[model samples]
Target chain A: MGKVVLVTGAARELGVRFVRRVQREPDVDRVVAVDAVEPVRGLGAASFVRADIRQPSIGTVLAEHAVDTVVHLDAQGAGPEGRAAGRAFAKEINVIGAMQLLGACQKAPAVRRLVIKSTTGVYGSAPRDPTVFDEQTVPGALPASGFAKDAVEVEGYVRGFARRRPDVAVTVLRFAQILGPARESPLAACFAQPVLPTALGHDPRLQFVHDDDAVEALRLAAGEPRAGTVKAGTFNIAGAGVLLLSQCARRLGLLTVPVPLPALRWGGGVLRRAGALELSAEQLRLLTHGRVVSTVRAREVLGFTPRRSTQETLAAFARERGAGPLPPGLLGGAVDRAAAVLAGARVRPPHRQEAERND
Target chain B: MTDAKVIPFGDDEGRPRAASTDRGARPRHRPSAGGRDPRRGGPPLSSVPEQRSEADALPPGRDAEQQGPGRQETGRQEPGQGGLLGRVLGDAWDARAARGLAFLRRRLTGEYEVDEFGYDEELTDQVLMSLLRPVYEKYFRVEVRGLEHIPSAGAALVVANHSGTLPLDGLMLQVAVHDHHPAQRRLRLLGADLVFSLPVVNEVARKAGHTLACAEDAQALLTRGEVVGVMPEGFKGLGKPFADRYRLQRFGRGGFVATALRTGAPIVPCSIVGAEEIYPMVGNSRTLARLFGLPYFPLTPTFPWLGALGAVPLPTKWTIQFGEPLATDAYAPEAAEDPMLMFQLTDQVRETIQHTLYKLLVRRRSVFF
Candidate 1:
């Protein structure tokens, strides 16, 4: 018999995309997408159920659907209105919502596999961090608060759930920043700005996974365990290679203003207060000391590799935003011309030919 | 020709007016004395004003006479370009200039690649190494020996004695390995957390292929067949007073040996002489160090007294000698976990470096020579 999959956080773009992908999987007999708010658009073949994971009533939806597989995708930082919707509300949806969802999943005996969407933010960016983090590397510094803390809490709850239900295969896919033309993430918003504010003297290595690859990874993890794939484990899902923040800005043809860490944080707070941007403390830490994780486990065990590299992913996002004031080709040409002129002036005497002719 | 030399023509206007006066004053004695001058063939006094007008109109032309040989040599090197336009373009579009422009274009377009550790090989090779080459060649006059001890391929750990109030020895060692080694392999140094926590130093360190001095990073690099350099006597040796020079500090719990054993990378003991006398740290101010969050505030004779000028290191002749490699592949993988084995290997490496330092110092004639 094919598997009955239940995906949470169906209203979000990533969630909706994941639901659409999973519903088409050969092994997925039915897909029940659950969310507090009704999706603005259609979910195709998948059925949409209006149920908040924060409440115990989510159990009824799971039991009614006989969900054999649960894909939790709602553990996100902020919402459509950004952090303007108060931290408490976001935390409630991310932490409490995951807790309640796990509770429901545990009671449903039909559920044999659980896949949770996690962020690499759990690794916490710090100066002392390892150059590249694998699955087993401990976070150098645990995040004090913010979405990273929430991710930590949610992962802890998932671990507890896994221990309680040893029969169920729990897969936690820790993904790097997800960027795509259709997605609207905090990083995307940051890139959308004309002037990107970066931490002075820091060009942290950043990694990104295309949204299509992210959905594909989720689909792979949610499906039934195949011969070459591990059924359940923690895996880092990110595109190969890394891009420096300055390089990203250059690629996007955006001007970068290097702000001191303290002033940048203060400015970020002001921007957040003014509802102009969403620069959380976690994001500031990320900007200061970029985080990169090894996706080897995801490739080796989970049987997933991102189709696009970090550079390619950024290019796609940049293409979607249209050309910036200084396209890379134009900038490169300008630099070449300036260098040629400087070189010419430095080597050749200006009036040498005229003096030789006169003589 | 004598007038050309006397007038201070050709790009002099581009310089400050005071510099032009200084140049004109120096050449005045030659013409007034009526001495036998080199290149004395010149036009009569009647043509002097016309020549001056020509020089004034085409200032850049004046340099061609002075740099005539160099311009001809450059033209001969680029044989295809014979016309005026080609000559002008050829002067600027030499092979070196072309290569440099290409590198700049690649950087501006973000086309170059950096490894997962943020190591940009192209930038390190072309830019960083060239910038350090002058100091490595002239300032330090480093003499490298026993380079054959380093493996031509595969992983090898180079444990060097750390001294010098600043960490210039590490950079010099890096240059020595790259310039002197037959394979021209790059040395990936593992630095302390402090090296990565600072602002400008952090970026340069990462780009120059230095990672955090952690066991995990070391193992990762070693397993990738990279030649990794480590200074086990970190701050303790670097900040030690001149009295303690050449005395290797405690090799930080033998962590490097453990990592080598884990990765089965041979440990090549490196002893560096002359670094100890560069700054001659006389004292360490603990109070000031704590106030500034520094590990140790060095009190050298010139520092703080001479201000920024004091930061300049004394030109001391340097000798970096690599000792025989200690093979760790013979040991079982479990040997890394054994503290006794780790201690024994660490002590052996430390003794080798200390003994080599004494040998180099005994053979040395003077520190500044």
Candidate 2:
């Protein structure tokens, strides 16, 4: 508990909040915030180091810090782009960078807990059917950017390392779409539309974890006594509320635009072959079929109690950004557009149908 | 793929009747050759490379049979029946061939039925009991209880802890349900996916009607109102080493309960005594499995590559007992969605199996067939 904690990619929004959370936690004595970008202003006396985790020398620098709890949040393409660049960057930072950091952490005797902030995208895109994807379900990730796949590979390494060294608690927290003030999560960009796009007959099951809860889980993971992969091995951290894309658009008061065409089954293949996309069709399938990772493991293992609801998360972001109300016809526009293609197709809410039992 | 369908050598009646005098004749070919036929039925020499002699082809018993007479006293062989020498050589040879073929079947195809009992008999359980009764009466005693625990008719989930060395517990439970229980029924088991994937395994597994181990498969079987048997312990519990035998591992977040919760079938917990000690798994080589993509490399005493293969299952008198049915209709389908509830139920089933194993083990007198 007296050891120093180093959070990579600490200058980013989620990374910064994580550093702040670690700094606030009673167990953490010192935090060394490391990032390739310029250090954020006013992060108060907490040590700051500027170094890209992808660099080979970064491990030596981290070892020099004498830091123990290494919370790796460093990754690339944390922004929207035309696939290739995003994927290359994500692999470099999340996968390659993580391995570099992990290699260093393995050498450092002081490092007891290495908490890596992974995405549930590692779980892959959602499924077409609304089945609750628990920790038990095998991860069938979508082809989006290579971020999820890369992060998942890193997680496998982390799990293997944890198994090898029971002394160091290696925690891989798979978070949902993280959204908060100034945070540029995929969800933020996803909801940043004047006309929110929607998938027809597919209301992807999404898990949105607030930055605060996300950090709290990391803090708890860093402090827990047991070191091995906890619970279903991977915990699905979501916010208090679960909502579909259409519902989110409705809540945002944004204009919904539904394409009348069938689900974009061939979009990923076309884009990848054209060198415009990095994710494969399987990866896209992950996106098409959303996941529901059971949070029971998190709650039981880490005693996780989420404070912010999905509505609260969006509203707080809106309030902080001073964003105005959503357009009135946003939701109806998409529904009307979808209905125009298939007449009499009911525009029912996604969660209206109860989760059917496999029976 | 179709090559998997070739009838086993012993079962090949379609071989030209004229060739029967040659390799087809029971004990004739062996003496003509040097003690054993080099052209024995084994995996294609291409895959395995080593073609063993009659003595070396099979485990020891095979040699004994081949060394003995396989021809009848009348010097005549029936269509199905084998003479004294034929019984010894044929049974031994067939069993060896079965073992070799079963192995190749598992490796190539990935499907194999792991029968807890020796074989599937068509006769009624009472008839089976009548056959075993003489043996039971001569060497050991038999008893039964909890006949009412089984359902009269309906597809039920017979959830049981599987761990009688080579799955003897599963066989006893099948027999208990078939003979002792009020409603005579055949239990369709949810076998590991590997059982169906392996070549020869697929044949035996399909014959036994054991499907892949998954909630979807279990639910489908149960939806049709078939008696489904499930071993929640999976590989962890089944493959537990000898020292840790009978100590149940965590039942993977109760897919069985979820299956029942989804299908509204009553989960009947079952316990079979005298299975764990049959041939305690001394060790399992995971390294081999990783290399072979198999679940584990089980190393049991009798199965030690080269030795007396028929280490007769310590026919430790087995008694199967079915516990009260745990109904799932009360819980909504979404109720199965509750991870906590699933975990709790999984643990309950594990405990029930463990407690039963301990009781059964205590009652067991010795280990021998």
Candidate 3:
């Protein structure tokens, strides 16, 4: 009999894509999609179960479907909203949601495979990180706050669940900052801006994985039972090579404004208030000293390699941002002028909706 | 070295491979005789491919042609020049501002790429090294001996005596290896965390391929066949008092020896004289340095009293000598695990450098000569 697969976070583009991909597999019989909200559009022949994993009712939904495999992707890109209510709401959806889901997965004897879409952000960005973190580098600094903290908490709960259910083959994919068309990340938001704010005088190394590569890795992780020994391994997924923050901006035709670290702290507060930057203070460490994770295990064991290089992933974002018409050379001149204005004189760049000036 | 050949250059143009040098790092315009290889007398064009050692043949980020409308090419008169004032303006722009703008533009527009380790060959060559060139050649008048000790290819650990209050010796040694070595191989130096803690210094150090002084980083470089330089003395060597100038400090626990053994790279003992005399630290200001978040506040003879000029190093005649390559390849890889073997090799390398430094100092007639 074909296994019945239940995928969480069906509303997300990644979830929506995964459900469709998994449904096409001959080995997978039934695809049950679960989330708080229904996907705006149809997700193939998969049944959509409207339920929040944060609530205990998600267990009833899982039992009804007899989920043989659970693919958790809800918290992949959860950002803590600026307000306390929003933060609490995000936590409920992410941390509490994962707790509820894992509790259900532990009880469900039929669920033989569990795939959690985690991020490399749990490793945290710091001044003294290993040049590249492989599968085993202890996160030097665990994220103190924000959605990233939620990820760490979720992983901790997942680990707890793994110990309880040794029968279930668990695969935690720690994907690098995903960048591509249709994906939304703090990095993408920064690149989308005409003037990219960066840590002044620092060109921190950056790594990225394309949205497509992330989906492919997820599919590979999901197709485990039919293949080799279904071992539980936390895999770090990323494209090859890395780019400096400045280089990323340059490729996108976005102007880089290097703000002093102190001023940037202040600016970050202001940005949070204005709702200009979707990312939190902790995310700033990413721009200050960017993080890179190795895909060695993922490549060798999982049999996955990202088709896009970091530069190519970034270029996809640039292409999505519509970097044309101004011409690259002229764009460079404009970047210098903007930087000179910011660094030399305290030019209060109309940073929010600042593009209205051209109109 | 007479095998001159032009590299087949199409595949490496736009695609970022890995940089050996950048167009930004064009060798300075110096007159050369006909048929002489002008650029720093680097390895023959035939050897260039092998010497660069970048597995992927990525050329330095070449400046893309971005000839904007309304801006004429800076040089060469385009027939009808708009008389005297326009001619002067054009001449002035072409002579000075154009080159400066182009350089800045190239930098801003990503014409120079940094490696995964953060080494920017262009920045190291064009900006940092250019600033230090005059000081290397003229101010210090650095006399390099035993360049033959450095291997023309493959990995070698340069275990050098680290001295001088500000550690100018590291940059000088980098220049020494690049300019004097037959292959013009780059030196990847392992740096202490204190250097990386500073603002601009951290970025520049990374650009120059000076990563955190750790075994993981060092081994990775060695395995890649990079010439890795390590100053085992670290802070102690740089912070020593003027009285103990030539006395080499303790090479810490011989981490470098283990690294060499593991990677099977020969250790080249390097002794640098005259660096100790520059900015002589007569006393240490521990409290003040603590306030500054510095390892040691150097109380140089000319410093604190003479302001910024006090920070200026005295023009001392310098000598850097490289001793014979101590082969770690002879030992089995397991030797790296043996603390006893590592200690013996570390002490031997330290002693060789110290002896070389003493000999060089005693032969010197004058400090400033």
Chain A TM-score for each candidate, in the given order? 0.93, 0.77, 0.87
Model 1 clash pairs?
A349-B60, A350-B60, A351-B60, A351-B61, A352-B61
Question: What docking class should model 1 receive?
Answer: acceptable
What is the TM-score (0 to 1) of candidate 3?
0.82
DockQ of 2: 0.01
lDDT tens digits, residues B30-70, model 2?
34333233334422333222221322444565333222222
Best by DockQ: 1
Worst 10 residues of 2 chain A by lDDT: A350-359
Model 1, range B1-369, lDDT digits (tens) per residue?
121111122333333222111211122112222221211343234333443453355436333222211121111113333335434333333433445566667776788788889898877775677568667666776777888888989999999999998899999999878755766678999998998888878888999999999988999999999999999999999999999889999999999999999999999999999999999899889999999899999989999789999999998888889899999999999988999988888999999999999999999989987
Strongest candidate by lDDT: 1
- iRMSD in angstroms, per model: 3.6, 26.8, 11.0
lDDT of each: 0.80, 0.57, 0.74
lDDT of 3 by residue, B1-369 (tens): 111111213232343221232211222221211112232244333334432343123223311221111122122223343333222223222223334445567666665567778888866765676566557766787777787788988999999998898879998999877655656789998888877656678777888888888887888789999999999999999999999988988999899999999999999999998899998889899999999888899887789889998998998888888899998899998988998888888889988998888888889989988
Q: Model 3 segments beyond 4 Å from truth? A: A76-85, A225-231, A324-359, B1-106
**What DockQ does every candidate get?**
0.45, 0.01, 0.19
